[model samples]
Target: MVASIKSAGKLSESSIRSQDDLEKVVEQEQPKKKWRWRVDTSDAPKEIFNRTLYLSILVFGVLGSARGYDEGNISGTLAQVSFKKTFGLSDPHKSKDEVANLKSNIAAMVQLGSIGGSLLAMYTVDRLGRIRALQQVCIIWIIAAIIQITSKNVGQLYAGRLIEGFAIGQTTTIGPLYTAEVAPPQIRGMCGCIFAGAVYFGIMMGYFANYGTALHMLNTSQVQWIAPTSIKIVLAGLIFIGSFLLCVESPRWLVKVGKVELAAQNLSKIRHLPPDHPYIVGEVADINELIAIEQEAISGSGVFDKIREILTVKSVRYRFFAVATMSQLLGQWSGANAVTIYSPELMGFAGYKGVERLKMTAVLGVVKFISAYASAFFIIDFLGRRKALYTGITLQMISILFFAIFVTVVPNATEDVPLPLTASEDRAAKAALASLYLSGVGWTMGFNSIQYLLGSEIFPLRIRSFAQSAIMVLHFANQYGNSKALPKMLLSMHKFGAFYFFVGIMAISLFWAWFFVPEVAGRSLESMEDIFSLPWYMIGRKGAELCPDHSEVSKIHVNSSGHGNAYDGKLDYDEKTSVHHDEGNSLMVKDSNEKDLEKEVKK
Candidate 1:
């Protein structure tokens, strides 16, 4: 089944001038056949799993690790007495209430800056290219790390944190997008999922570094506390080096910009295929064809026009934006960040304190990172995105609800009250702690990974970077809100009220995902517009579509046997066989007049 669409732009502009073109445009469909299901990679050559592919995916993990280091390191920093005293956050002169407010500002400000970075990425990623975008963010991280290492006051620390956050937003935005674009269709989910896992890997790195730092510098010299901040420099430096040395620009972006020859070469280099290799040739042709239609639809003349095109067009609006935005919304409301960034303090409220609380925060970081790796390497491909998320969101909502209840009923539970050391209180705290970590399993495994994967898969070449940037910006906005709201809410509201609030939000998100999110696991990126052209309800349920038997092929007469004039087998993929078959299902016009039109244009 050829799933690639016709030259939609030409078909549209010249429809009235040619009858033969109209015949060529007729779409042929066979009745649904009983085809068996196999993985999409069956069509991919075994060379798909070679070193270049692994290195490419692992490098993005490097990007994620840098992000996680910043995100996870701070939780451990807060546990250090030296860190607090030097910053005046836990100064003797300050009231507990005052200190809490300061902590909230310092922690939440990072996310506020990330929202700005996400917004900026919308234009810069589309313009600068993915590799350059990553290089620029790496420099930002390096600068921020230096500021953090040299900081004396919370104000300076906040500045560094905000800069780091801004840089992180862009890395996370581009990491998965790049992953999805480069990976073979069969393993795309696994490769893309690694981006989230790498983030957790960074978190683990940050937390362990902080843990080590706290052991040595808990109450020592102010300069000693800078150890963990200094670590970001190393991780970001590695990414800076890798950005230039390890990666090629996304071929899809190259085609969108009219560099088709370069795009083909890059595709060959990345896929380890000869330029004329069927997959490479077919893909390059499809990219050119789809890009033409996308260019026709979305004008890059100005930012406003691109924005209007996405919002105004139904296929772009419902399939890409709506699904991407909702998934991001869940990422924010999943309640993972509350635990990841603020776990030490959050655990303190559950009666664990001092070094023990810090250790427990590291443990949660371990759980999160483990979940991320587990999902990245294994669960995502087998279970697919929808089931993983359904399982994840449902479990998380249950855990949060239980956590809220347990914390609320603990003896004399009150806003900003530290958990006491009594036996009964300790038991209650332990139970709440169990629920929290249990939810981490779901959060990291499902919400964290799938959101990034979905955002990367949904957009077209013409506007992918821009659309992804918008989605990331919106994602950070929610993260910023949660960052701002959680610190205070945990202190100001009923001890359990925040969890209950999260319960309501996650409950709504689960339902939204069930009805709206479609399965895109093995589908080619060039075929997304075709996927959305059909009714939304039919998207996932219609498995690999089968092409008509070879018997049906001989009767048809073809005009131009061009590369772009083919259907992507994904829409009509036969599940019984793993191969991706292209049926030349393009809209071709048959006329000397049309042919002469092309000739005259060339003259």
Candidate 2:
């Protein structure tokens, strides 16, 4: 394999001057073939999928469970009779509005704390590095969990939730960012989506935790709520330990801070290749070149200048709005978080009572978990990002709209209480329940995963941490507003009103995404600039088409004749093959074998 790679590298150095030259070489060497739609993983080297990489991703990805658990566990916790009594929410004197206010305050506190956490991460992610920053997040989370576990009053619990929110905010920014930085470009979408998938994993655990405690333990037992809240400590502990024992710092972050040699070493370590190998060298070169360009474009070394650059630079500013701001704002307002955070209550509205509500919530979690991974493993890369967003959001719109229509026509439940339904109302409630589950699936597939994925990948490295932090701030802020307002909205706006509102917001989201979101399925982080280089108005429509085709750069080829085979550093070989490294553009190509030739020529 080494000999074949060396020969391919030598041939590329001798003959491939540009992308055009590389394409011409491929065209000349390969036979024509037909086209078929599929997820392309041909560019990824098998070594990139080593145990270390998977372990590291798992370490960081599980951090999402913290966020998911908080979102999922809290509603069930709030519903526990012991918890409500302990928190003074079960007082007979309290009006429905008062109870709703208390619930909103409890739920929104974490989001409030998360806003500050996001701001804190802007500095920590860059100064401390991704792994170290996340370790700090775990420490804060453990402390907050301890506070919640020991709290004797609502004030104390609120304080703990606020502290926990601070940690979760940091995880939201850092986890996906680290995963995207470390993943090989070919499988980046699948790998990046892992963080989002883990969120549902956490949600499922939280729901089941609540369900188990509710089933086996008395509702009046404080342990019912406390047991579920304590899960946070275990998750935080695992992530903190794994950070030290399993994970490596992001090589891109290493490169950004003028540690190019260290970056290359880390990159090589992660890729499971020698540092001098053409593949590793070429990757490092791409990171270095992009960083150099970003630095040159800036006028100063201060944080303020970087912030200014994001605003002053047209492409960067546009990305800041189109990808960062809009994705978060639209996603949060689309009401997915409301469903996740209030699944039990929504299930109650759907006519499932008491423990059944918790069981239904758990089912929602399972559906979301499956859908999120389905998107990760099959949809995002298979359909491409834009299409996934389109498909997922469309599903959400249909589901939410169906839900709104059902609630509007039926009298099954109200914000203040659940009504005993007639047989038809009961059937309608089941359909509504199915719609919410569908919404969860759609949310997981669309904005739930894509929001995190885009925030992590779309920005330039120079602005990534800052941009992601900003996006998270927006994410939590929107979440806080929605969470704090949802109970009141359900009561005042009527149950169906909130769903209708979401339908409207989702409509706007669908159109905005159609005109603004670019397809970035298999593109490298370094090549993102080309996608954003077109004018703001043109980027959504033409960016994918106009960008240099880096998706195919990792293709490895072998011809039947065994002559003129091109290699892109990936180690697939039938015979001795030549590899080409277009260092200037970071383009790697392998000539086509009979099968690859037929596949390539069809396009």
Candidate 3:
């Protein structure tokens, strides 16, 4: 749209040109928009990130997928190589206890490393920028890969797994945070799931890589070990280089570290703001406001006082508890990781032998990848976070229950269960495999993806890193519990009983999530402070709303029927006037300080 120029009767052509030039100059100094827009501070959705932000998030997601691939690939592909032989478990006739112990140790080692990495992440993620720390972890992953590839003993190999697991822990925490922080509100939910989806994709890649390698007999040769695992190494190297070169470091992190100028510059670049764009101005203002809050929170405080402040903040406390507890519960009870880390062994127990087990794992990986992609696109938005989680968890619980019942009833009735060579075959073994595949699909849709997304959402800016790290630790603890005990439990109680244990845990998780887990689907990450201050019921209810038109202040009415009504409005807080009028001329309050009192009334 062109600005209309009005010429008075005495206007000169030179003056008109001069006026036009001044208008151009003013326009250049402002953010160009198709139309004038105003964002209401109270309910505005987060500013949509620009091309740079999307690129950075995508890069991080790719690296995250690679990291996830490394975590699960070793489980399914170990059967083909001297991984068993190299680990001194070549004979199937070995004592069951010995084999169980060794596998447990390998699985347990990853959890151990995760524990360490998580603990370290809690402290360092804030100090080091998210991109910088992830870059450093890429180096750590490479070293771990080198150790695993060069190992002569099981101990060395396990050590490598531990180190890699540690790296993954850091990756898990930072990758989601990076994506969440960078994403535009329109796509933030999808962006948050990108890592989980990527991981599933990576799992598929790892499975295919291993399956093909096994078919080609690559891992049998020393040179092939380097090639197969080298895929990750090359990916890791690319991630490190890409992060430093192409990735945009978080503007939030820059602001936190007192780099205001750098933060503003980065924000402008990430938001595609012209030098004097309005978005740049708004971002700078937001940054300053946050910094001011941070200063006020920590001012004149010692270390203990600072800690007290964080703990005392309702937002921080609720998020920390919600994320940590949910992670631990889901991690232990979901049974997806259990199936992933021990799929080969579980398939063996179900009577699959030789390469068939590995192929089945590849199939499982494919199902997981496909389902995760579907969920990434559809579930988080259409179903809302809480409902999607509820549905997914319920389905997962049913799948596990079916598995348990089948093992207890059907498998016991037949002396030999007929196995199908193809997915089309209607054999009992194929049916069981199908059940396992469905179990993975349920998990990808619900627990695994939801946990990461929820963990990122619950925390506010001040303790986002700390809260996520705490949850990660709890998550691994649950993983560790399963790795250390599930095998032994299966040995003593049978496969049916082992699955029953997970079912029981899943039932509890479902209940906890239903009752306690707050919905955070469309809420801006910054609005977490507002969410936490609400009652539990309201928190999840609002979380279910679509976008909430956050670009303006929302005036909400307390309904007599208990379902509230909301509209866009300005909350006028005039200290001089005894009464404050909402945008609709509604008497929002009779006193300016009544706004503070109204919070208590709402509670």
Per TM-score, the best of the predicted structures is 2
lDDT of 2 at 546: 85
Residue-wise C-alpha lDDT for candidate 2, range 330-432, written one tens digit per residue: 9998989999888888887787788998999999999999999989988887788888898899999999999889888874464447667889888888999
The true-versus-predicted C-alpha distance at residue 359 of model 1, in Å, is 0.7
Rank order (by TM-score, best first): 2, 1, 3
Candidate 3, 465-500: lDDT as tens digits: 777877788887788887778778877886678888
What ranges in model 1 sit over 4 Å off?
A: 1-40, 299-301, 412-428, 535-603
Tell me each candidate's TM-score. 0.82, 0.89, 0.78
lDDT of each: 0.70, 0.82, 0.66
How much RMSD separates candidate 2 from the native structure? Answer: 5.5
What would the C-alpha RMSD of candidate 1 be, to one decimal place? 9.8
Worst 10 residues of 2 by lDDT: 569-578
lDDT: which candidate is best? 2
Q: Write the per-residue lDDT of candidate 1 for residues 353-404, one digit (tens) a residue.
A: 6778777878888888888777776667767778788888888889888888
Cα lDDT for residue 434, model 1?
86
Candidate 3 residue runs with Cα over 4 Å from true position: 1-50, 91-94, 218-226, 300-312, 349-351, 412-426, 536-538, 541-603
